[model samples]
Target: MASPILPGSGLGSGLDIGAIVTALVNADKSAKQTQIDAATKTNTLKISGVGSLKSALTAFQTAMNNLGNKTNPAFAGFTATSSKTDILTATSDSTAVAGNYSVVVNKLATGSKIASASFAGGAASAIPSGTLKISQNGTDYNVDIPANATLQTTRDAINKAQGANGISANIVTDSTGASRLVISSSKTGAGSDLSVSGIAGLEIDGTQLMGSSPAAGASGAVNGVAQNAELTIDGLAVTSKSNTVTGAVSGLTLNLVTVSPGTPPTPAIVGVEANTKGLQTSVQAFVDAYNTLKNTIDTLSKATPDEDGKLTVQAAFTGDALPRSMIADIRAQLTAPGAGGPLAVLSQLGVMTDRLTGNLTFDTAAFNKTMAQPGMTGQVQQLFTGTNDTNGLLARMSKAVDPYLKPMDSKSKGLLDQRLDSLIANTKTLTNQQLALDLRVANLTKTLTAKYNAMDLLVGQMKATANNITSFFASLNAQQSAK
Candidate 1:
């Protein structure tokens, strides 16, 4: 900012030129300044209003997506149940057919466990110096034993070596203070059993047990063999390498936990059916979400006076049509029929809208009752999620709101973004105009100060001339009086 030029006071006329110049400059700049400030404030409020509306719409879109997700049970999926969950558990997806099957778990799949021969020196016993090979499923994992290595060191070496197929080793001491090296494998199956056979003092093949000495009878033996899980679904034999079984039924996964226990071996009844409760909850949540969005829009576009009518607060978007138009489009989608079906509308699914307030109300009891009807749950889910060819209700809502709520880009822009862009541009122009106004005010002040200084100088010169003439006349009169 350039400093203000101090105007000179008139010497002869005794006029305050600085005050006059200041008043004139203020009067000249005030109107333009008020106009710029008002425009800038209005534009800022409009930007803030559009930003808030866009955020609310984004939250609504997220809530809608949750209902349309296939894994969330709202999208016409299925739920599976086992009567004896302790013996078996089940899970199903949307493609699963509704049915009941008798599941008999004869045996659960198991991994391999082997205990090595007892060492006389316990952990301190010297292990044979050689390559120790642990084999499982045709993969031999070798552990090189250093010279003077003890049973403890051998176990450490086995653990440190990367066990290709999930191998672990530990030492178990017997009653006579003898340390037994026990090794295990996580691979499960009949043919995938584990065996150890590279060194003499540590040789095991399910039955071989290495004792204290080389010639002594070995005490090591296989504790458990890798075996496949045996189960029967509806008397149809099913064998699995792992307890967690899949593909035994269409779109169903069975987790075989334990064998069925009874005098005649009781079977667990596994059933698969549509998940209605989850879908109902999702639908209600969507209604609540819509209501929340509507409330925000109402607040932003509100045009009302206070109770006292003395002070009225101007809303952020009082005259803005963008918020209203965006809400209208979304409401139209919500009211539109969803494809050709008996359950094509939201009202049929118990989602109703208020006429006066534009808020949504969910009738959970009505929804549950409709879901209780035979095969109506799937139809309602389809109404929200839609099929391959037809657009669903949620899909339609996306189409309606995406144009306004999507992120701004080069090719296209959201409505809120466009409004904000124009507001920012206006603010930028106002800022430039304000600068120009200030420059003009400074120039005017400078010019007026110069003119006032020049006039004051001329008045001082004229007063000096008048004083000279008066002095000359007084001198002549004094001379005349002396004569």
Candidate 2:
């Protein structure tokens, strides 16, 4: 027997049946694989589905990053309203006015009788609270006691004080909505607080003092009149109960306590986490498909085999032709090295699959770092491009399979056209051959039939002759017996 070709090697072996069988098997397998690969490329299984998914994820991620780094003042919430004058102004300190203004009414009058009073020392409490009146110029004023007032009743009674006094007290609510009576001088300057005289039942800590200064143990009552408390604002004397002065400057709020407003407006919070979440979902899908393809490759490329020496693959996947090529395409893209390439190599991105376990683990921090680097995005595109597209993974694969696919170059000899020409020119060749075969079959059938018919006729004639002979012999035997 002639030498047989080895299956995998595709070379003839000196009729070694085993070698020949192996060669045939391997050759058939290789050819089948090539055909499968060609089909896969034409179908665009790996490129269209997985590649598009990854590209979309990458695009979204880039968008998110760009949004994150954007800085625009309009994005920060800032709205301000002012009354006529600019909220902020810059004037030389030396050229400002020195004079101060004040407001005072003459005919100060009060109610016939004082009801009650309170003087909150340093704390705000509802004890020792009452009502009183103050008569300034010709206007009569009744002071309402706040819920949280103390022995400051003498100060409260000053509401009933009648004279050329230049101070007035009123109750106002704070930002927290707490009511507190405030006492302020009609005059803003050195002597803005009260100077009690005509009013009785008034004293600052029990000692008599007339000016804008607070007196220790000022207390007293004269004809049901109360004393006054003193306070200062910006070196100008102004007084109030539970003072919570705000809006010291336009567009700015200031709590009377000990604090200054912080500078600039705090940036408004915006939600971009939704976009990141979407990107993550897309990326995860890419990861899953990639892993599936990787698993297919691992199964086909496994060194270990079963007792039948066949690779272990899912039952349906066994002998499936698509997986190996898919893996090769992926592996080629991931491992291919180029200067400043999207990843340089898969190892840089922690995308290398474990040889032993067939598992793909990632170093997220490393991957992120790489992505953040300059030119990383372009490199990433290159890695996914493979060899298929001018820029894709399948480009290389297509080139390799070029020999198996359509002809690389058309024949210049016009063989195809010539073949058609020959068929047209010799149309009778096929007819003649077909006619000859038909006539030969017909003649063979006729000859066989005629011979069989002639034999049947001969056998009939012989049988008739033998029957006659037998009848004659029987007659003769009977005559002899009679004689």
Candidate 3:
């Protein structure tokens, strides 16, 4: 919105011809320019508003999802603590219940690590042409030994072969310049240890020691025999071939680190308890996230009036149905009953909504009292994470925001994408129209300047002619007067 008289090139008639042309062009362009400007402002506001809504909704869904994870479920998780972490450690998932146990780790399971006597000829010791047969847990893998195969090559062959899944081999050379082929099995269980044979110089007894390479009986034990994990939970015996024990105590996993045997037996006290504080924190975070989304919607779609009921201030989406409709759709989901449990609805778990603001508020004290009841911890968790059907409050809320979560550049347009695309196209069209109008104005200015300059030239020629005629008349009159 500018003044009608604008600055332009004015060289021809001193009647301010430039100003006149500018005024004419302004008069032609003003109304359309104003319309375009207003439309652009409104569309830009809508784009910004929708983009903000999308971001807020996406973040809310993320916070909600973090609480709904199955493994580390929000307030219902049972934390497992081991008193003697040096002897043993414990971990529990959502399936674990609160309980105390006296665990005694008898001995740690040891894996078989066997070594060959020695290769006095170092890593270059040659072997006989026979298959190096390696067996573990009734499964056998064979490595073809070519004639004149060196000790290092056989170890490399065993390490690289496909069928040798858990068999490891290496040449360990002592300071005496003697290399011994040390091989170990990844298997830790009692009857699952690796057994190797079928080659002459590389035949090493997995249980004992013997002579060296080219001696026919070169074998020895590096870390001795394999054993199973022996431990007791609550005085009940539990034997595992591996040190890491699972399924022995329902949902608990016990990792036997070392021996804690004898006198009072050095027992490990493991305790599983409900994480009530974690549950409370998660609920508060969920409520806060939802409230943030609600606030954004309220601010963007706000249409407030003065005391006289006259709207003096306007917002981005004021009087627009889009924001209102979106909030209504999202709000309607909270009323639907959650997928089955003792805690049937969100309000039962203290997630309540305000009557006026439509924002959620969590009643921590009330929730804590309800959770304090016997066997209500897991029941309360089921409210947000539905059983059999994933139609819980969080699930429904996530679904509501899914439409707006898509990136703007995505081809599969989101809720706000179509409107944004339309606005952008409209803005471009308006720009083109403005450019066309400017071109026309420039052309008109040039035409008007040329016409005014032509008229000025004609006026100047007439004045010159009149002056010449006047001079001639004066000369004639003077000559006559003199006669």
Name the best candidate (by lDDT). 1
lDDT scores of the candidates, listed in order: 0.79, 0.37, 0.75
Residue range 1-483, candidate 3, lDDT tens digits: 233233344333346666766677678777877887887777778778767877777787887777776555564546678999989988765457899999998877878777776778889988788899877677778888888899988888888883247778899887777888888877786776666789876776666634333332356666557778888888999999888899998768888889996687979999988767777887787788878888988888886787789755566778978777777777787777776656776686688989998888899888888888765666655666656436766777787776666655645777677667877888788788777766776776677666766776677677779989999999999999999
Task: Residues 37-69, candidate 2: write the lDDT tens digits.
Answer: 454443343333333333433343333233222
What is the clash tally of candidate 2? 66
TM-score list, all predictions: 0.61, 0.26, 0.69
- What's the CA RMSD for each of the models? 8.2, 29.2, 6.2
Ranking by TM-score: 3, 1, 2
lDDT of 1 by residue, 39-72 (tens): 8887787788888988888888877776666544
Instruction: Output the worst ten-in-a-row residue range by lDDT, candidate 2.
Output: 86-95
Query: For candidate 2, what is the TM-score?
Result: 0.26
Q: Positional deviation of 329 in candidate 3, in angstroms?
A: 6.7
What value does the lDDT take at residue 77 in candidate 2? 14
Considering summed lDDT, which 10 consecutive residues are worst modelled in model 3?
A: 1-10
